[model samples]
Target: MDALPRAAPRPHLPAGALGLGALLVLAYGIVPLTGTSYLFEALLTPFLALALAGLGLNLLTGYAGLLSLGSAAFMAVGAYAAFNLSLRLPGLPLPASLLLAGFVAALAGLAAGLPALRLRGFYLAVSTLAVQFFVAWALNRIGWISDDSPSGVITAPRLVVAGLSFDDPRGRYLVSLTVVTLLTLVAWRLVSSPTGRNLVAIRDNETAARLVGVKVARTKLLAFAASSFVIGIAGALWAFAYLRTVEPAGFNLDRSFQILFIVIIGGLGTLRGAFLGAGFIVVLPLLLARLGAALLGDGFDSGTLEMVQRIVLGALIVALLIREPAGLAALLDRAGRRLGRRAA
Candidate 1:
């Protein structure tokens, strides 16, 4: 009998996965001990939520090649939906409310995605803009969604889950971190599945994908639904866990742009890019302000400094995009491969 080819041994864990796990452990376990309330509540929590949002968009645009600009609108849907569910049901649990909120967002995503069946590229993108505007307007005009608040705002309820209130800074950070971690894992798995392969095919060439028996419409809608589900949950976390306030303006076009930028700058198709881009988005402004203070001294005009910061940020983004069209994730990936090759 012919000798069977030797089977290659597989590593117990993928490269960087173990490092990521250890980093997460340190983040969840030791970082809280630092007792930096500002970093925890103001920075890390918000970054996590935004990273989740980026991951959601990345699923659609990165893997599926469906561009979206209304991520914030879906997020708003989730925030308001969860708020109303918890408020009206009274007995509804926080986890249930969050899940329901995601469902609501998914429904809305389907509604928005339906139009995508007929449209392509720029037209489809433009169509989603309508959803963004319409949702924002609805939140402002519709009294019931906002609980008829005089300010057109909804204050988030206490994030109580089975007698545990995540009201403290560390608690809130942990909650956000946990949710983001789970969702990230799920997304990783999703992108590795058969469905993910179909979506990528559809993205690379819709006609070829259709020829290969892929259901183009179905795959696209699923992408939208799945993306919106995660984004919606992130939105709920943004409201209940991070800001503790819900306002339509908070999830406006600017927020949409920010999320899109995170995806773009983080690396379109990679999951880790979301976090890297989000961290850049969150910390860059602070760093810019400090740089301004250090360079020009505290006596520098605040407005002028703000304008300078924006200019610098814009320039940096343009330069980075021009230098590495695939974003920072690709750069890191290439560097890692080079190091491995050298080590070998």
Candidate 2:
């Protein structure tokens, strides 16, 4: 029998980017059709928001080589800014408020990042941590942001845009998908532009970048501003679409570290890594808990299972870093290239 004719390879974008885009389309387009509200709301929505936050951090830490530990603070600024704006001006649209919140966060990022411009490495990181503590304190101390709630918790404003209310799970998921998609596209372009090249230069060697007229200081601040803008939007989405509640405790130091871990575990300086890392962060523990319950049945306690999950997660992160420091995105790229060669 004659062998089947070899199929021609179709031209495409980078495999990682194309594959991720397709996966997102499937997630938003088809996942809800399965009628799994838990996956959509409890998992995917938060995953997208966190991924957006990771992407923002990747821009600053991964691409620009700026060390930051105040991502959650920027997020808090975004959330509280949106909360106050929406509260003060009830007539504002939700989408508009989110955008404005992002800008406000950008301003805050510029302020916090300016002083740290003279610092580098560990000092820069430590400087950013001050923003985290200050923002958290401000949120609790400022009654206007929380509306003086006795519990110090505030509910998110109603999510309404153009006569559409995203109160339901599917609606929220769609909103998140739309926002993330657009922002991802913008980030992709930004990273490929001249600005991104300067960031790379600054990251590699600040002196060299300055010698070559990169305007190192200005670029560093811009990186922070751009990163904060995106993170701020993510924060708003996390509160308005995912959690539907805001408290200073929710955006703590741990939250900042979680975003950092996502960037590290996903693959630094790459767009696809953000989503990959978020999937790992969001799905791994849930899988572990299910496995524990299946194995231990009724004998398993929630606290013990959670502890086990943390241990496993830490071990896996260590293993992955030791094995492939570039993270899962690099692994997938390698796999895709091999398959393409085989197909050829």
Candidate 3:
């Protein structure tokens, strides 16, 4: 008797950029077909918006050593700006409107960041609170911003692009996927360039960065602008794709806090952490509700479950800080290394 010859080893597929591109193609091409409305509406859309928000905040806080409590304020600026641009300019494309909206948001960010020159840490954070309050007040009191909507809540217009309407969940999801992917790539490129190094330099030591010929003031402002641009787009997506409305009250201090939490929980100065943290934040509440119903049966109540979810979330955040200060991305890297060792 003779042993059968083993089949030739399977060829390994491409990795790195090519592999990542393929994964993205798979996600964009297949996910919508297989996913439901709930998946798009309840999870992916919100996650993309929040993750993008986290990414923007990380650029300023994690890399540029600036603090902000006015993220949602910038978002409102983007949302309302886009709304107004598209509303007034009937011939303009939605994407163009959104782009202009981002610029508006960046300008607003620049204003909010002005106080950073004389402030840092908690003081900087407090100064940004002024931006938040002012933005909220303006949106509420200014009828022009809302187009004089009776309720002061401006519902998003048709999510149309290239004559295709992105009014449904599937369409909205695709829009978000495209926008988030492109922006994430841009962010990666920015962070990989010399500007990113300057940011890191500033983050490490302001005086040292200045001594080394880095224009600390200019760099900080540019960082704020770039971050605000991304966040502004995220804001547009939040209103147009997820919430489908631009209400000042809706994007309040809590929204800014949530974005901040996402950055902290995801990990500072890491792009992957943004998405990972957002996934956790968006999915946790739904998961908690499902688990509560499953375990507690019919006795569980919505209000009670909401409280439990918050408690659990707080506890988990504390545990994560204590156990892995670097956040979920660090945990993932550790796990991957362990698995690779076993595989080898």
lDDT of 3 at 89: 93
Please list the residue runs of candidate 1 whose C-alpha ends up more than 4 Å from where it truly belongs after superposition: 1-14, 300-302, 341-344
Task: Please report, as a residue range, the 10-residue window in candidate 2 with the lowest summed lDDT.
Answer: 5-14
Q: Please, what's the RMSD in Å of model 1?
A: 3.3
**Tens-digit lDDT string for candidate 2 (1-344):** 44443222221124656766687778776787875789888798999999999999999998998989999999888888899899999999888898899999999999988965799989999999999999998888878778888545879977788998888898898888888888888888788778988998999999999999898888999999999999999998888889997788999999999999999999888888898999999999889888988999988899998889778989999999998898888877788789999999
For all candidates in order, the CA lDDT equals: 0.87, 0.87, 0.87
TM-score, candidate number 1: 0.93
Error of 3 at 18 (Å): 4.9
Q: How would you encode candidate 1's per-residue C-alpha lDDT over 17-86 as one tens digit per residue?
A: 7887788778877898875999988799999999999999999988899888899999999899999999
